[model samples]
Target chain A: MILRPQLQDIKIIGQYSGRVILGLGLLMLIPLLVAVCLGEHAAALDFVIAASFCLSAGYVLILICFTHKEPTWKHGMVIVSLSWLLAMFFGAVPLYLSRHWGGYLDACFDAMSGFATTGLTLVQDLDHLSFAHNMWRHLTMYIGGQGIMIVAITFLVRGAGSALPVYVGEARDEKVLPNVVQTARFIWLVSLVYLLVGTLALSVTAFSSGVPAVKSFFHGLWVAMAAWDTGGFAPQSQNILYYHNFTFELITISLMLLGSLNFRLHYALWAGKRKEIFRNIETVSFFISIMLLFGLTAFGLASAGSYPGVSSLFRKGFYQVISAHTGTGYMTIHPLQFVGEWRALSLMGVILCMAMGAGACSTAGGIKILRIGVIFRALLEDIKRTMLPRSAVVMDKIHHIKDIVLGEKLLRQVALITLAYIFLYLLGTLAGIALGYPLKLALFESVSAGANVGLSCGITRPSMPAALKITYIFQMWAGRLEFVSVFALLGTIIALVRGK
Target chain B: MIGKNFVKIWLVFLGISTEIMMTVFIMLCALGISWLISGGWR
Candidate 1:
């Protein structure tokens, strides 16, 4: 493994460059194979053409430049950041070669959306999309959601310094074990097992219920990807609502719940320590919050008389609740239906669920579960202190199995960041409302996009105002990393350009 | 906060996969070029 310490001081950049060049040559085959196997000769040729250019450039860099045995933090960050950038560069080749995009940035945006699992689209027509393109889009979601970085940690390298920080950067907090590679292996195993199980289960249910076997399998494929990674990429243009079946809705909801629970819980369950499974504060908070928020949304929907049938209400209500809470963003009901008909409180409820996001070390976005647990615990301590006598001084502590951490700093950081997230949410909302979108619809779309909750009101579309699209894209990127990583990326870039 | 060092390490690792993809891309192209030089498909 080549470790780049500090950005500019990347050691072994020359040595490993050849290996990287070699690796790129190999990975370009998957989709190419898929294209050929699927009988899409044009797609195959397109991929072949794009593959050549990228491979050639990568080889030149690897063979000519220095790749040392060590890379500093700066170098590692530079490499990783540049790597994703380069991925977007190389990834765009397929999209551009297909002649689907007008400009490379647009292609990059679409590729990033897929790789980031943001699910938002710039594709002008979903109904008319080529099969190869469709397959590629979903495949990117599956890859990105499992995480391209964690894939590397699991597949290519086995080291602490290289894996730990990178794993965290991929938006995971390792709880089941200390070793990053071990944690990565555990996560991948759990996810793969779940994916296999989920795909089979959904496929059978969908098939038995009358959908064609092939269609059912594809549905299973995309939904499994979305549910496991908490990515909201739907197989059909209509999203989850396309099925509109109670059985399908129930199956998706179950998958979403399974995926949103923290991976630590899975580890504990696997280890046969049943007691450790539920004791994690994040798990408890997630369930409690789900019950409270879901009940609130259901109540709002019921009261609105939006669904004449009880079944219809449950279909829309439960799906939206799970969708928002998990930050999976797969909507069962169109935002057009919910507008004005649904009250402000219900919208707020949905938004709050999205803002909380999935548990740590999971693909779902937003503020995450552990930080919420921290802030909630901190709040409880403050209330208790107020209830006590004036002379009382309270020492706050949060305990995990490893140790009891007692400090106001961690709580403060969590609270401040959560607050900042809300502020950003508001800014996005105001930007939309200011741009002539109706009051409620604009806020809903902005919050939905900003929170990485794939739900949207009437305003979100391929032809959405370009300014609005830019806002949503920023929101998606910022929300996916919870603001901090993006800031880190910015700082690193600035430091590299100016500090050197 | 999003740790820069952590995300960087991740990116480097992910790049490995991308690197693999890039490598694979080259192979296919090489095959295509060879096939063309070998008299294109008869």
Candidate 2:
């Protein structure tokens, strides 16, 4: 029997959701300041209106749903899912006001894409986009990559006990520190340090590429945010290719791989647990899988004679493999070249890498290396047990931060999540195929959206069917949240409508 | 005190450098394998 949610539950969820919204409203001021400093008065005004609307709505919600009680797990889950949807709407305000999108829906799609760190874009005249709006777009990736709930917990929310559910709801379950707040701060610390380092490296590379000093700095900062978050937005429409510098591509690829690593692993490494890098299952799996996939892609492209020599193949083909594997989607090749030039085998290799993404509890989405590693170990253990005598026992353990036993419960959970991702990929593919896309392109785009890897096959544009855009949006949101929070939201809605 | 802080900073840098080195090595390996498969040696 389902119990209906009480008024108190609603109040708790609403109050926390309002706090998240208020925090988002405050974030807009950063870009607003950027616009003012750049003397983009028209763009500044758009942010002003959008910020005011967010502030007022947030304030009103807090007042209407005032509560002193801390959020329970249910309240936290509901708040996270609800706040993400609201964040998409509010975040889209300035984007819509910029008059670059075809409609509010297009803005919303881009907003959701940014927040989910999915990197798909639907804006027009992207090259001519204002500096402030571009700042906001990349900022969305930074915020979403760190988990929006984390920002609120670090800055706004007071109670640590209440922060855990929302933190877990954002698909960040591993706590690097003992306390949730401490973990949030630690996550921020790691990101900030990397941000400083990554931005400087990219900026120098860009400057060497002959971009002007000021443009190089901003471009470096924006790309650092996108790369560090594994959110593949670039300042210019050409993405990393605009610089045409191998050094820049190398720096971004390094950052993308760094971003895809588990934050806990970063903590361990920073704390001088260097051996963990070698012993860790995720890193080992990532190395093996990337090498295997790159081999496939390289052979496929080689057979097709897509590139003339090994140098071009390594430069273009290897970059795409790593980009896809890390879910960064920073394309050197144009989007159309994916379908028009690349053969099916190469596309399949990229798709597999996107599906088997890097690191659990990291910014990169998909089934995650941790789950894949565990499942593989579990299969080996089973095989060993079968080959041995009936009385023999096989025990398998894998190292993350520490050695974790391969248990049936863990395997079941891993299998379920992997299946959910496959289902999502299939769902988005069906949507695309229904709209007259070819099977290969549909599957590629579907996995791209569902895995939050923003690689496109020329199908994502302003003119894509409205339904397809919405489907991809849902896919990005659900994929980023790892289905737990979205399912919790759905269960809540069902309880509201049909509960006894 | 400055020396201690320097060591700490150096350790952090070293940690990041190690990760980057590992990434570069893996990428080089992948590149090398691809080179072999694509008959780059030929």
Candidate 3:
């Protein structure tokens, strides 16, 4: 018996949900083949289970919930948010059930790390991992960065209204093109271009560093995805320091900024809007924050004598600054250095940078700078109104896509949400501190997790207390979707419990 | 017409990003040059 969900409720799951899940399942097939090729019986078996689960799950969902109704904006958010949650949940299976990893929590942590493009890992010895496994890990970041939903939209059978929420939930709601599918297409193309250029450069650097061709090729692909997504997963057990070359660091830095940028800027460029580079407020803020934070951090680190010379001073400080600011989470230096010395001032700069996060639609996660800009513009409006007489009235406004959006109510809503972000941060930190971790370490871990920055001061380990792990997981979820979608989920739950 | 506008805007933005890319290129060259002058990596 087919139970037709209400048309409204069906669209709430997003358009073509089954096809998208099938695609995710199909993506697993390649890794399954690779595992089979390597003759890793256990790994192949794991993929077989995962793929079957995804296929059947996708098939059932499609068969049961086939609806002609189009997705509205509200449905788009619900479906996209929940779809990611579902994908992450099912996606964790291969890692979770394998004989290699013991705990379910750790497996989910690893899978969420991959999907969220957060580089935090709980794996003890990455050296023992098979090549096929590492490649699968890299592929997860690649798919997650561009978004599997956006891929669904780009090839969507019904194109009219399907692109809006897919684009919006994929985090690129700002219309660079009139059609959202075109915007999504343009994003893929730009990413491909960067991937080609970035991989070649990184490959050359790695090869010159005496890394083998096979190692260079695989590592190059891994770094490209990680850096391009503002993700910090390193191919080596030691992360980026495995190469330990300044040139390698420089290459990764450039890629992180490129990945952190909104695709609209790229689209605008492809269309010959040279001024869009300067006109982009998010890009401007990203650079300004990097510079200001880098300057202060380098000075403080140098004064503290963390490194010997000025070049090395700029080198270490700038990389860490970008890693944190972009939420890429790669670290070349010991966290102990950042932790023990320059605690108050350095951490302040670092924390503020992580909170600012990356471009709106880009893979880098957190509250996002565009929303922050909206909040800032709102504050300025308040200040101006304070100085003006009672009779005077003001309109709040913000700039985007070469136009102004004027609405005080919208601005107030954004500001309120930003305040909510701060509260979430403090709450996570307190939870960790209350559980018996050092105060500073707890605060750092909370911000890192909450911002999805993925850089641990070495505090989060396999041995970390269970209560702390739970805290970090919630932070990662809240940070990745931003607080709005989580709040929306909470509201839905509340409504069901209270009313229905 | 919208597609045309989108193309024009993208190309113009691309041109500016080219300059930004060039700045990065030049800076990278400087790093290599100074490294060479300083007798290469330690």
Candidate 4:
């Protein structure tokens, strides 16, 4: 029998979600201050109006839904799913005010894309966008990458018990520290350190590459946030291509790769367990997968004679493979080049890389390497079991942060989530094909969106069908949350409608 | 006390450097293969 959620459940979900929205309002102040300082009066006005709306709405929700009760697991899931939608809607206010987007829906699309760390964009005249607006775009990536829940848990949410479900609901299951709050803080510590190092490195590179001093600093900071977040948004429209400097690309490659690493691995290394780098399953799978896929991509490009020399091929070809594999989506080549220049084989390699993605509990998206590694091990165990005697036991284990026996329960959970991702990928591909895009291009863009990798094969544009845009938005949201929380949200709606 | 702090910081730096170097090595290996297959040395 399905039990309908009570008013108390609604209160609990509303209270926590209100707190997140309140936190989101506070976050907008960073860019607001930037606009005021830069004398971007027009942009400052947009942020002012948007921040006021968020603050007002957040306060009203908190007041009406006031509750002292701690949220149950169901409430936590509902809050997370609802909070992200609220974030996308309210977050679009300032963006819509900027008028760079075609409509409010377009603005919401970019906001969801930013929060999902998917780099797909539909913004027009991106080059002429104001500095304050640019700051907000990349800021969403930073906050979203670390997670909005992490910010709230680290600063706003009290009690580890309350924070845990929301943290898990954000699709981050592994906690680096025992307490969820400590884990959030530790994640912050790592990112903040990388922010300093990455920003400084990129800033110096940009300056050396001939960007003006002030512009170089802002560009560096923005790019660092995007790359380390494994988000593909650039301050300029051309993305990494705008720099056209090899050193700049090299720095971004390092940042993106580092960004996609599991935070638990980061914690392990920081705590002096250096050997974990070599022993960890995700790293092993990542290394093997990248090499095999890059070989295929290289071969495809080679047979096509896509570029002239080794330098061009390595810089252009290998960069995209890393970008796709890490879920970073920062393209060195133009979008149409994938369709026009690269053969079907190379595009397929990139699509497969996007589908597999990078580490779990990090900014990168897709069916993470941890699950891929486990599934592969499970397959081997199954093969061994078939060959052995009837009474023989196939002892299967996976070495993640530590060695763990792979039980039936674990395999079932992994298989379900992996299937969900495959379904999400196919859904978007069908939507693209329905809109008259070719099969290969449709599949490439769909996997890119569903995996939260932002690479485009020239399909994403302001002019695409609204149905396609909405489909991609849903794909990004569902893919980022990993299905469970979204299912909880759907179940709640069903109960609200049908349950006695 | 200051020396101990310095040593800890240096080790963290070293760990990060190791990760970066490893990634770079992978890229170089890929580049080498691409070079060979594309006959770039010629």
Candidate 5:
């Protein structure tokens, strides 16, 4: 039996949640600055109103729930989960005010998608959207990728013990540093460094591809944020295809891979542990899975005779496979190409890649390569145990930043999370099919949303069913939190409803 | 001191370069396999 949450529990959760919302309010200032610089006074005013509202709401929560008590683990988890929902509502304020969405629900969906780092969009006339709104959309991904709670922990939240639970609640279990604050700073450092490098690379490629210098810089920065965060919102509806350059695609591919690496691995690499890149189980698993999926997709495309030559196959076929696998959702081809042109087998291949996703503790979502690696290693260990004599002892180990023994507890955790991901994928798929979409397209879009992958096979549109939109939003939220925090939030709700 | 700083910078550059090369290498391996399966060499 669970005890009902006390008022103090609510206060603790509210205080932390308010702090995170305050951090988000601070983040909204980025787009406001962008609007001011671009001389979009109307858009700047929209941001001003939204920011003020967010700040005011956050302050009210903090003031009302003011507490001297530190947040417990349950409180941290509750805070993280509630903060995401609140962030979505508050984040949508500016988007809704922009009048680009059909309703507040649509704005909330896009805001959730952005904050979850899932690239699905419900905004109307995305091509005609304001620079400030577009910046906010992509900026949400960058913030969400590092985690909104992490920003709070880095700046506002004191007490290392209190910060750790919130940090872990955001689906980042790996502590890159001993202290949570230092880890948060390092995460930001890695992202900022990559942002500068990726922006420059993309800007040069964009300028060479005929975009004006100023526009190219902005586009490059936006695309860099989107790709590096694996958030699929592109400034233009055409996405990567808008630039029409292979060089630009190549740069984005690099950014996506780099972004999907675990922060611990990034720390290791930065510390000059070059061999760690090769020896890390997640890296090896990703390399193997990507290659196999690439082959599967290539064969499917070739069998269908979709692309005439190897060049087109690499450009069209390979790029989408990698993008899907990385959960970046930077599509060069039109969404219709997946449904009308690509065969079922290739579609399945892309779906499988999207479901597998990138490294653990990274921005990208899905089952994660680390869990995949652990599962495979566990299987091998089982096989070895069966073959070995009764007296023989088998100890399975995998290298991350350090060597970790693969115990049953670890395997159980991996299996549980992987199963939960598949269930989430199926839930979305069933919802899609119930809404009259075909099984293949339903599965593709479901896995895309559930995996936080932005790839759409022509199903996600402004005119799509509102039920499906809400379903994908839930999937993105649950997927990004990896079900743990979501379940915690659900438990809290249950306790409130039925607990004595 | 200048030489030491230069060496440090060079090491960081080398580390970054190796990582990039590894990324490209993996991408190429995938592309090459795809090419082979597509019968492009033939």
Candidate 6:
């Protein structure tokens, strides 16, 4: 029987969601302070108005939906799905008020992209955008990378049952610590530590590369946040290319790699389990996949005579492949270079990397290394089973933080998620092709959007059809959540409408 | 708290170092293979 949510269930969900929105309002203060300090009065006013609206709306929801009952697991998941949509709506207030976006829909698109850490932007005149607005853009990446519910869980939510469902709903299945709140705190601890070290290293590099000291530090911190979070929004339109320093590129690359690592792996390593890095299935799979893709991309570039020399191939080709593989879209090359210069084979290599993506429970988006590792192991298990005697037993295991036996259930779940990601990628590609983009370019952009890798090939602009924009937005949202939460949301809506 | 987590701090450093080293090693191998396939020393 299809169970429909009651009004009380909806109220409980709203109550919890209000608390998260209120937390988001508090987060907006960081950019507001930046604006006030920089004397961007107009931008400061926009943030002020937006923050006030968020706080007021959140308060109103909490007041209206006040409930003494604890949220059920279903309520937690529904709240998380609805909270993200609410966050996108409320988060876009300042961007819309700035009048830099084409319309309210475009503002919402960038907001979702930012919160998803997808990095595909629709902002117009990003270069001239005020410091406050720019800070908010990168701040969304930091907030989103940690999972907005994580912030609420760390500071606001107290109940373990409520916290676990929202955490899982955010596409993070592994808990680094026994307590969900402690796991959320540990995630923040790791990110904060990296934020400090990465920003300092990149700041020095930027300053040494002749940028003014203050601008260097600001840009350094912004880029580092984007990189380490695997959120590719750049303060400037030119992205990593604007720096033009090899040192900067290397630092960002290191950060991206760190960002793509599973948080559970991070915990195990931090606990002095140094051998875990080598033994983990995801790490081994990532290493092999990256190397394989890198070779293909380099060969394609060489055969096409696209890059003139070995240095260009290493700098442009290898860097881009790694970025896409990590689901970090900080591109040193221009968007036109992908469409005009990169060969079909090279583009396909990048598309594949983006589709495969980084580790599960990490900031990156796509099918994830964990699933890929599981699928590969499942295939090996099947092969062994076929070769062995009928009475003989075959067992497959993968070491994450610990050894986990590969079972039918695990294989089925991994395959299902992988299929969903492929379907989402194809949906966006068809939409792009229908809008008159070439098949290759359409496929590239669609994969980029669907994988939450922001490497564009000159197709995503303000001039594109609104339908395509909305389709890509849907793709980004569904891809980031890995389809389960989105499907749950759809199921709830259908039950409400069609249930007897 | 930071001072108490000294071992963890050290391991975090080691972890990052290992990642960088692995990345460099793989990139070099990829470059060498690509160079050979594209007709090396031309």
Give every prediction's interface RMSD. 22.9, 1.4, 6.2, 1.6, 1.6, 2.4
lDDT by residue (A367-441, candidate 3, tens digit) is: 787777766666788888999999987766555556666576666766775776687788778997898877777
Whole-model lDDT per candidate: 0.66, 0.90, 0.72, 0.91, 0.89, 0.88
Ranking according to DockQ, highest score first:
2, 4, 5, 6, 3, 1
Q: Give the clashing pairs for model 4.
A: none
Give the better candidate number (3 or 4) by DockQ: 4
Q: Write model 6 residue lDDT over A1-500, tens digit each, in one string.
A: 78777889888888988997888888889899999998999999999999999998899999999988887667767878888889999999999999999999999999999999889899999989998898899998888889989988989887777788889889888889998988999999989988998999999999998999988888989999999989899988899999888888888888898899999888877777878878999999998898888888888888899875767777798789878998889999999999888998899899999999998989999999889988888888888889899999766898889999887898888989999999999999999889899999999999999999999999999988999999998998888888888888888888898876
lDDT of 2 by residue, A37-99 (tens): 999999999999999999999999999999988988878888899999999999999999999
Tens digit per residue, CA lDDT, model 5, A428-466: 999999999999999999999999989999898888998
Name the lDDT of candidate 5.
0.89
**Sort by lDDT, best first: what order?**
4, 2, 5, 6, 3, 1
Question: Once superposed on the true structure, which residue ranges of model 4 sit more than 4 Å away at CA?
Answer: A389-391, B1-11
Give residue A487's error in model 3 in angstroms. 3.1
Is candidate 5 or 6 superior in lDDT?
5
Give the alpha carbon lDDT tens digit for every residue of A209-298 in model 4: 789998899899999999999999998888899999998998898899999999999888877788888899899999999989988998
Q: What lDDT score is found at residue A128 in candidate 5?
A: 87
Off by over 4 Å in 5: B1-11
Interface DockQ per candidate: 0.01, 0.63, 0.21, 0.63, 0.59, 0.45
lDDT of 1 by residue, A1-500 (tens): 22223532433433233334344445667778877876888888877877787678777766666443455443344444444545556766787777766566566666766666666666655655556666666766666676666666666554767665556655564646878788777778777866887789788878887889876886787688777777777767788777767666766776676677667766655544444434667766776676677566656765666643445545666567778888777788765766856777677778788778867767677777678888888779888988999998777776443335658677677777788778878888888987888777777776766666677766766566667766776776666555555665576556656663
Query: Model 3 over residues B1-42: C-alpha lDDT tens digits?
Result: 999888766665566467458337534543443343333467
TM-score of chain B of each: 0.64, 0.85, 0.80, 0.78, 0.80, 0.73
Q: Indicate the TM-score of model 1.
A: 0.82
Displacement of the residue A498 alpha carbon in candidate 2, Å: 1.4
Best by TM-score: 2
| Candidate 6 C-alpha lDDT tens digits along B1-42 | 877788667877876666667656766776776666566668
- Candidate 1 docking classification: incorrect
For candidate 5, what's the TM-score of chain A, rounded to 2 decimals?
Answer: 0.98
Better of 2 and 6 by TM-score: 2
lDDT value for model 2 = 0.90
